[model samples]
Target: MTLNTKKDPRVAVIKTGTTYPDIKSRFGDFEAWFIRALSGNLDITVVDVAAGETPDAPGNWDGIVVTGSPAMVSDRESWSEATADWLAQAVAECVPLLGVCYGHQLLAHAFGGEVGYHPDGRETGTKQVERLAASDLDPLFANLPRTFPAQLTHRQSVLRLPPEAVLLARSAFEPHQAFRIGQCAWGVQFHPEFTEAIMGAYLDVQSPELTREGLDIDRLKAELAPAPEASGLLQQFSDLVLQMKKD
Candidate 1:
């Protein structure tokens, strides 16, 4: 469907990777989870940048959500430049954003932050995220628990942030787990949209890689522990984009 389908502001979801062969793909899970969390309120547009389609009219989109990709942000891939350019324009347009996993690194990279491969390889587990707010609180963190369970299955991370970006959350494994650029824009290294069951199936199917990397399967599964209120954060994400359009 086109953006004209709804009067509600459209949200553009940038998909930067291919679907998985063995199990549910990152994009597959994300769309299902995000749509469910959004409750079919806003119109959703997806741009498959990996397939070489650059997004249009950042100002037209109420907000942007960049999805996780298997590719590294530092890699000189064609899609990297395309998505980065859209990010810069979106920044200028002041469009809200939610960047997940590799999306977080891409946001950092586009805005002059650094990203690199973690020497420790990858941390594929459920981890606790601590809010490191500099102010009294952020609207996004309004009702969020002081400490909550989040699934983090990533390797590369933002070594630093853009001057305009603010750190919102962190974990022991990464200093920049979540950040906000300007206002209405957010990037989280952890997968707030990932459900435990989906993660469990994913880990089981990806056992070969887990075994090769010597990752603790138990820890990873545990990290995906139940979060009854986790959907609240995802809903907040879609809400932010819709609200930005009112301005």
Candidate 2:
């Protein structure tokens, strides 16, 4: 059933970037994963900031999943400012939040911290994350493994978290992988919603970036070829949203 604006959970998947050549900028793997997360039941609308906002559906939305952007988190631009406002508003309202990639960075920057280029090589492929006390305590990773496979793609990462944030997961490559704040807000450095195919396209789009950062795309592609177990992670994230709505 279509979730009426007056009832049912409403999730706003904010598109932070328009893909090059108009390759359907829905964050590569988000649309399908989101539809699955909502069990093809809830009302979902992808709000492209370039075109306009999500059309003021906050009254209708029960949750928000902010998508990552291709641009740098430190950049000062109109889109960045507007997106940051959305993040602040979401947290102030205590709306259930799940931020991926740039969304995660946006959260860190919005609350109180910095996100910028990491000298560490770009995390382009699949890797297993070591669980922490934060993970054990969080329901976000309920069904996921202690060391789960996740697709990593980005140039910038969370250097420091908002003081209230609790880290959820990490890896040898990236430490601030996943974190949460005050129970309802959560952010992940990796995309638990991406597929190898979708990521391959992202790599292709960011090949120049990889090269600029002195990394090898061939290696990144080879490592990411093996799909990560994000379906379970996404399911867990979805479950968290469902439970948050119930509360």
Candidate 3:
């Protein structure tokens, strides 16, 4: 049965980079993950910026989601920089947006926040994320428990939040785990679309580096558990988009 019979809200997924070839073969690409994570509820379109696809006009889509990337925001790639400018314009227009992982860092940089290598280093594996008190009142995050677990793998983080950004969540390793800008834009440092298999695949590929960093690879793998609550955030965000279309 169709979950949304009314005209579904249109959402664009800005593909920043492709997934690891092995991972892509297994789970499709970033856009596939997002579509599945949201349970195919919204009318989704994909814009692969890495391949030179331009984002849809601001008036075209009801909302946008920026996918995580292997490239660092600090690298200042031309395409990446251009996407940031577009995001700034989208925010100015009050378009609902969700940025994940590298997308999260890029959102911060686009709005005057600092992004760089974490002071301590990479944060990989499933970890607890604490929703800040401010999240309690957020239209999307409200009523969520104070803490939840999510899959994460990143060497860079948002070291400083953007001006006027409302912080929404945090973890011991990532202080700016989540934040909101304007009334409808959000950035999450964790991967709400990542499944346990994907998380394990990441850990497997980074085993050498993780071991060298004094992280227990086996323990990290052992601690892996499903983060259903974390994945639900995507559904909530999509619902917010639907609500926005109504108003």
Candidate 4:
């Protein structure tokens, strides 16, 4: 429940949206997934920013994580915009931050980058993501392999990264799969928190729409596998936060 009194990093997880009813019943919501992935070493708090929950100032926390959402960043809803503003401040304060999916797009938007629906449409299921040469210099991604499988399900994406953002990784369909701003802020388009089962459930729930969109559901389901490397990023982030707090 706690780490060393002064050493434990206080982390706030900003929940942007809820998962499907079935998914929530089976695997819990977006925040739960992130908590599980991040593990329990760090002190973590969930803030439902989508529901008007305002979190403490970014400086109060040692680290911050923005969870993926069913909501689209392109809509720029009042709450989403407000959260973006808060994230901007978090970035300014140099908080150790990781934004996933919707969070990724929101971060880019907050930094004046462009976010919109992918021209090629939604990218779903497990896919191979390749790290760019720039990742070798990135603290969070430096040790990762050149290519790895990662879970993904997104319609909107960070079509353009912030001027100062460094491209970290990319998939065949998504050029902005992962990027980092400054030293501590990161945004990943892939769902590092998603397990194989969760990815399968997502495909099942979106089967009708996928079919209508001309995707082969069976093929996607069959390709589901554990993405250990991708999932491990959460723990790596926890380690980074803890180390930062110690300093």
Clashing pairs in 2: none
Q: What is the lDDT of residue 140 in candidate 2?
A: 72
Candidate lDDT (C-alpha), each = 0.75, 0.71, 0.89, 0.92
Instruction: Tell me the spans in candidate 2 whose CA falls farther than 4 Å from its real position.
Output: 1-7, 22-33, 36-38, 54-60, 208-212, 225-228
Candidate 4 accuracy as lDDT: 0.92
TM-score of each: 0.90, 0.83, 0.95, 0.96
**Cα-based lDDT at residue 179, candidate 4:** 96
Candidate 4, residues 189-242, lDDT tens digits: the string is 999999999999999999999999999999999899989999999999988998
RMSD of each: 2.3, 3.4, 3.1, 2.3
TM-score of 1: 0.90
Off by over 4 Å in 1: 1-4, 25-29, 228-230
Please, what are the lDDT tens digits per residue for candidate 1 over residues 1-247?
2233666688888877743655454435455565656637788877778877778788878878888878889895877877887888898778878888888889888889998988778877667777775523676765777677777677798888988888888877888888888876778888777777666766887778998989878767665676544446667877676666676
lDDT (C-alpha) at residue 216 in model 1:
77
| Evaluation by TM-score, superior candidate among 3 and 4 | 4
Lowest-scoring 10 consecutive residues by lDDT in candidate 3?
1-10
Model 4 residue runs over 4 Å out of place are 1-7
Model with the higher lDDT, candidate 1 or 2: 1
Candidate number with greatest lDDT: 4
